[model samples]
Target: MKKFMNEAGSLAADSLDGFVGAHDDLVAFGQDRKHVRRRVLSPGKVAIIAGGGAGHEPMHVGFIGKGMLDAACTGHVFTSPTPDQILGAIRETDNGAGVLLIVKNYDGDLMNFEMAAEMAVSDGGHRIETLIVNDDIAVERTARGTGRRGVAGTLVVEKIVGAAAEAGLDLFSLKAVGESAIAATRTMGVALKGATVPQTTRETFVLGETEMEVGVGIHGEPGRSRQDIADAATIASLICRQILDDLEPAQGQRILLFVNGLGATPPSELYLMFGLARRFFEAHGLVVCRKLVGTYATSLDMAGMSITVTLLDDASLGLWDAPVHSAALHW
Candidate 1:
């Protein structure tokens, strides 16, 4: 309810315009400015396009730059972009080489992006392959009947896949890398409080000061349980354990540890949780080889965090360390 906007319904469009204005050197707006693409599209490069709702900033958009997404479709708050909008992005980026669609596993995103792919090919016969990210260990299915929710792990896939694209990998090989990244990554999150979408008058969900929702998805879908909040270490244990046990990688394996704040949680707290996660790995013989910590993915002003673990071999580790320059991440 309390948002700093002149109007409500136009949040996505208005915010995207402001973003283009602020980071014009890094990204450019499509005809309507609703679609975002890299300022300079590489002709021979395999364009990586991704989209979803708008509440989660710096995702799908912030990652739009060199070594990340080539184009991103911005939708209304928690709503999928129309086929036409995605089609606009696809046409803007494709240049001889094919385009890869990196979609999160959600009903709206799945359906809309698929329709957009068909429209893109139908419009001009461009080749497009879509990869669905379903790395969340939160639940097998949500109310929308999608597979597992795609949470923070999607970022790693974007980075690795983007790096592969930049390495001049063909579309088919790039998609294989993306799928491998998705399979190797796992994510879990807990919400101490719910987010209030800019378009909505009420918070997405209500939580008591001393309560928490475990296994939360990015869009504030109901998690597996709502119970009294626990300490930071305890919280890290439960979430990290579930992720590690489910992954069950070989002992002494190296991995990337990404800890993300929902929206309002501070770096101090996120790092605290990150430290606890490292400790857990150390005690269990897993190596915390490379790590990215901060608010890479988030809900709108929600006070919580998610921890993502990606098992890394030489190939993924090299791609993970590949230089990246984007609004949210820069190296």
Candidate 2:
């Protein structure tokens, strides 16, 4: 419940103002600050826009820059951006080449983006396509029948697709690239501690000091299971096994391994987890060609991390290596 801000009601907005100011050279706000957009866009290039809730810092917003999303529509903490907000982004970012929306597989996100895309096409006559990322291997179907929730694998999708878009790929071609990346990606997360939503001033979930939740969602949603806390090696083994079994990458397959901290985890621990995860992958006969480790996608101050594996081919590999300059990711 302890946070520095003007007020709980304005936490999301306040934080955004500071972020926009800090990275103004790279990004700017759309009308009414509905979205964060790249300061300079490559005219006629496919515009890549990704968005979702607000608490996952350096995600949709932090990723707005060269070789990545041209714009990002952000909502209140853990809330979906409204259709109007999304539509505005589409209108502003779309040049001749059209806009691609990268949305996570959450009910609110899916519905709102769909509404906006429909509006943009029907009203604005803008060509817009949507790519839904469902790489979280933790859940095949929610109680409401929603498929796998998008987790840290979202970064993989955005980066690869962004690079392709920057390379002048058309709308459908970029969509194809995004779909291929999603198909090759799988992720799972574990929570050592729960996150506290500023508005409610309460932790999204409670965990005993000795308990941990496996396969947790970014929104602090219930995970696959809760169990007594175990050592890092045990935890890494359990998570890597689940990911490899599901992804089923062929032996010697090249892959990009990402270890994303969920807001509160420290770099030291994240790196340790990465080492353990790499061992697991190498032991299984996979080649770790590209690797990223950091606090990329996060739940508001949640102390945990997620592991993502994307089977990589030559085309995807080059796209990943392509130059990118964003608030959160650059190479």
Candidate 3:
């Protein structure tokens, strides 16, 4: 129940104010307080914009900079930004080439971003394209009617495709690269504890000290099951198995492994999880082409980790290795 600020009534402008002051070099708070996009500009190149809720820090906004997202719109915690906010970002970041929206496959995000795109095209006369990322294998067979949900793996797609856009790739090519990256990525996560929304002042879910929630989504949605907490190695194996099964990377296939912290999981634990993931890949005959382990994407202070494996070819690998200078992620 302990929290610092009021989530419901706390204006998005207040949050952006603190963020911009803290990282002036990395971001510039837009004139419209509701819209916060990356300040870095790339003339003659297509701009990339993506965003959703606020709690997923360093995501849509943090990725804004030289090599990642051109702009990002932040909504309230766990809620999608309004269409107006998204449209403002498009108008600000769009150059003559075009603007691409990297939307996660959530109902609100999809709908709101789509509406903004339509508005941008019809009213603003801007060329707009959209790509939806749904890489979470945990919800691959969701009973909620839809298939998989987008989770931490979205960071991978944004990084890869953002690089392509920065490299002067056209809108069509950028969209193709984004879709390819999403298609090649698969993710699985386990939650140790629930996160407290700023406004609620209480944890989203109750879990016994010895229990863990497997197959969790970022929004504190109920996971597939609750089970007794196991060793780090065992947890990593479970996550890796799901990712491998869904991705089905062949022997000798080069891949990128991301051990992402949900929010509060320590780096020490993440490294341990990475070790288990490495062993799993080695056993499966898959080569770890590149590895990134950290809290790249998180769900507030939720204690959990998600592993994303991107099956990569030369093009994808090159795109991934491209230099990126962002607030949350660099190089």
**Candidate 3 lDDT, 106-213, residue by residue in tens:** 899999999999999999999999999898877756567657788888899999998898888999999999999989999888999998877776888878989999
Model 3 pairs in collision: 7-199
Between prediction 2 and prediction 3, the one with superior TM-score is 2
lDDT of 2 by residue, 1-331 (tens): 8878778778889889999999999999999999999998789898999999899998989989999899999899999999999999998899978999999999999999999999999998899889999999889755677789998999999999999998989999999999999999999999998999988889999999999999999999999999999999999999999999998889999999999999999999999999999999999999999999999999989999999999999999999999999999989
RMSD of each: 1.5, 1.0, 1.6
| Model 2 / residue 262 / CA error / Å | 0.3
TM-score of each: 0.97, 0.98, 0.96
- Model 1 Cα lDDT, one tens digit per residue, 1-331: 6776767888777778888888899999886876899999877999999989887887879999999899889788888988888988888898878999999988899999999999888887999999999988988644666779788899999999999999999999999999899989999999998998766677889998899999998889888899899998899999989988889989999999999999889999999999999999878889999998999788877889999999999999999999998889888
Residue 176: error of model 1 in Å? 0.4
Highest-lDDT candidate: 2
lDDT of 3 at 267: 96
Clashing pairs in 1: none
